[model samples]
Target: MDRNLAIEFVRATEAAAMASARLMGRGDERAAMAESILAMRSMIDSIECRAKVIIGEKGLFDGVSLEEGIEVGRGEGPELEIALNPLEGARVCSTGGYNALSLLAIAEKGSIFRPPAVYMDKIGVGPDARDVVDIRETPKENLTRLAEIKKCRVRDLTCVILNRPRHVNLIREVREAGARITLISDGDVAGAISTCMPDSGIDIIFGEGGAAEGVMAAAAIKCMGGGFQGIFRPKNKAEEKLLLARDIAPERVFDTEDLVDGDIVFAATGVTNGSFLNGVLFKPWGAVTHSIVMRSQSGTLRHIKAEHHFDRKPRY
Candidate 1:
């Protein structure tokens, strides 16, 4: 994949987020997501690239329609595999809650890890703890160790996790361990990156989310110099076959670098308020998007606040 092709994908995501953020709290998430998906699709259609949806909300083989998939690169760019969560926190956007985002990650062909569409147990650590936190350890003990490593009070540490039943006990343990809790309705992608950005005020992320997202998060963490570890949790025999069919080893433990390698770029546009970035805001003049685009090879993380003028509608 041409490294520059990543920017085109980012632009398409920006367009999608702009269209989606307008629907927040409007009592229509599917419509909002559909609009975003369409906008993304249109944008991707304009790209000059060949890409595959290696890891996306839909199963791997299902191509994001001109109305689906996270909008990727120009139609004729690089032959890349994309992992996308078009609207990562649709519920949050619908309720005007928090942590909604339009996310996408691209890797050179065959670089993305393909796991069963199952749950993944993961632990994310911030720059403060660096190599100190380990997923193999008890979550409670890891919190304590992280606090010590960071030289901060346990209460000062913030743990982020998806607000789900599976995480209830983990939340309680983190709170009991004296770490602050920041539960998100969705968007573990943002939650994972938050730990690495001190400005985001999140110190760690623990618990489970989709296996594909775990790998995507791992990619970003690798670029940001954080720590992430995930173990895949296949739900059924079919999901198990999905992995085996791909020739994926069932017992592999995926670290950040394993998900994406070579020249890599990641961009996220916030759809609702969250730790890493504020959601998109539409103004009288145009639409504004808050995004963070990072490249692992260059160690560059650019916080971009971009505006697009939709002054004229395109003619079909």
Candidate 2:
């Protein structure tokens, strides 16, 4: 992939965020997601890559969906594999909550993992504690190890996890282990990536999330020199069969290399204010956006803040 495409990818995320930010607090998640997808797809169509969506809107059974293997872009640049979530947190956007964003990861063909939509057990940490935390370990044990690596007390460590019913035991154990917890509504990609930032105040990310998101988060973690590991937790026989047919062992742990390899590019634009980036701010004549673009080859991270004037340019 061309290094210049990093900024071009940010444009796609920015378009999605700008298009859906207007629907904030509307209490319509589906509409917000639909609008975001339309905006993201529109922007991607003009790019010069032969991109194929490995992870997208829906599954194979959906009548109308952007499932795996769908080709995108204008077919004039390098062939790429794309994993995207146009609206990372639809519920967060609809309710005007925090940590909602549009995100995507791109890599050379055959470099990105193509896992079926399934729950994955994931554990992520920053470079400081990367070698200490493990997904196969108990939550309490992992936190204790992380605190030791950071030279901090167990109580000083803050763990982030999704606030869901399935996490009741995980939360209880973390609390029992004497570590602080930051429970978020959605967007584990942001939660996982937060650990890599110096002042994000997130020491570690633990618990289950979408398999596709696991791959996307791994891409970012790899670029940040962090550590991430995921194990597939298939819910049914169909999912198990899919994994078996692909020769993916359900019990195997997938590290960053197993998820995404070679030079990779990741870009995200915030739709609602949160830890890592700010939400879009609409002005009288236009809107402002905050985005982050990173590349693995050069280990470069760029924070982009741009303003769009409606009067100066036509809306897509």
Candidate 3:
């Protein structure tokens, strides 16, 4: 893919963030998500690529989505696969919480993984600790190993995880192991990617989250030369049967390449401020957005702070 497309991708995320920022703290998650999806779809449709939604909001059985599998873009450029979470933390955005974002990942055709809408047990670490952590290991073991790789004590490492009932035991183990923890209400994709950022103050991410978000995080990790691993965690017998029918093994660990391969591009625009990126700031004249766009092919990372003048750019 042409490097210029990186900025074009950021536009899509920026549009979604700008549109949804108006509803911040409105206590309407679905409304915020709907506006974001529409804005993202509009901007993405104008891009010069033949794209398909490999990972998106709804499943095939749900019969609703941004319709996943529906082709996007202008139909005039390279064939691509997209994994999008237009409003990654809808609940957080609605309640004016942190780490809300509009994110997307793209790759050449057939390069992005299309995991089912099921839970996935995931573990992520930065490049420095990439070869040390393992999903098959217990939380304590992984933290001990990562601390060793970083040449620091376990107490100096900070792990991120979703604050949910399922993570009670994991949180306990991390605390017992003496590692600091950051419990987020949502947006694990941001949590996962934070491990790769030196300033993010996050060392690793451990927990189960949406498989789609896992794929998106894997793309970002790949661009950062970090490490990520996930195993299918079927919720029930029906889900387990579905996975088996699709020939997906529940115990199979999917590494970075298994999730996304070849040259990849990842972009994100923050809707609400958090550790990695700042939230959109609306102004009388326009709005300012903070975004990060990266490509694995060239290992280029760009942080874009853009000001959009509504009068001059009515489309925004």
Candidate 4:
């Protein structure tokens, strides 16, 4: 795949973010989501290249996706795998909350696993705890281990987890461990990315989320030299069967690099407030976008603060 694909993907995500941000805190969640999803899908369709969506929400065959697995490029280039979350936190956007984003990643096809879209249990850390965490350990145990590595008190550690039923026990464990807990309603991509950013007020991310997001988060982490581990969890027999159909084993573990390999680029535009990037800010002259674009090959991270002016209000 061409390195320039990242730039193109960034542009698409920025457009989607702008559209989604318009719906922020509006209560018309379905409309806001529709606007963002349509913008993203339309942008993807315009790419004249064979691109495979390795990790995404349900596609066309499921009746939810408008165009699923559509090929874009005709040239015989590297098989490209694209992973996307048109809006990572629709709830956040609808509520005018935080960390809703438009995200995308492109890599050499077959590098990313076509895992069933099931929940994934993961533990993530920054460079400080890369070699210290294990899945079998308790959240407290991991915190203590990390504190030992960083030579900080357990109270100094900040653990992040999604606010959900599955995480109640995990959050309690972290609290009992004396580490602070940062609970988020949605946006695991932002949560995972937070672990790698020193100023994100997040020391590590633990618990479960969309398996596809694990792959997308890994792509961003790979560019940042962060650490992440994910184990696919098939919730039921049907989902497990889907995994087998895809030739995925029941108990496989994937690291950051394993999720996204080869030369790749990951980009995200904030639809709502988030740690890595700010939410889109609209102005009279134009709309401002806060975007993060990174290239894994060169480990280049670019923070793009751009303003785009349109001839008129965006229709549809």
Cα lDDT tens digits for candidate 2, 223-259: 8889999999999999999888988876899999999
Look at candidate 1 and tell me the lDDT of residue 58.
Answer: 45
Q: Could you list the CA RMSD of all candidates, in the order they appear? A: 3.2, 2.0, 2.2, 2.7
lDDT of 4 at 64: 38
Q: Look at candidate 1 and give me any clashing residue pairs.
A: 47-74, 47-75, 48-74, 48-75, 48-76, 48-77, 49-74, 49-75, 49-76, 49-77
Per-residue lDDT for 1-316 in model 3, tens only? 8888888999999999998998999999988888888888889999999999888765332233466788889998989899998899999999999999999998889899877547899999999988888899998899999988999999999999999999999999999999999999999999998999999999999999998889999999999989999998888888888888878877999999999989999999999997889999999899999999999988888999999999897544
Q: What TM-score does candidate 3 get on C-alpha atoms? A: 0.96
- Alpha-carbon lDDT, every model: 0.76, 0.90, 0.90, 0.81
Runs of candidate 1 exceeding 4 Å displacement:
1-3, 59-75, 241-251, 312-316
Candidate 3: residue 140 lDDT (0-100): 89
Candidate 4 to truth, TM: 0.91
Q: What's the lDDT for candidate 1?
A: 0.76
lDDT of 1 by residue, 1-316 (tens): 4566667778877877877788889988777777677676677678787777766654222244532234455556567777776777777788888888887777777777765667898888776676788787877789889878988778888888788988778888887888888777777888898889878888888998988778778878877878888877788999888878877677676777666766667778888878778888877777778888787777788888877777764311
lDDT of 4 by residue, 16-134 (tens): 89988988999877777777777777676666556777676543422335233655444445567788887888889999998999998888767776667568998888887888998
| lDDT of model 1, residue 241 | 88
Candidate 3 residue runs with Cα over 4 Å from true position = 59-65
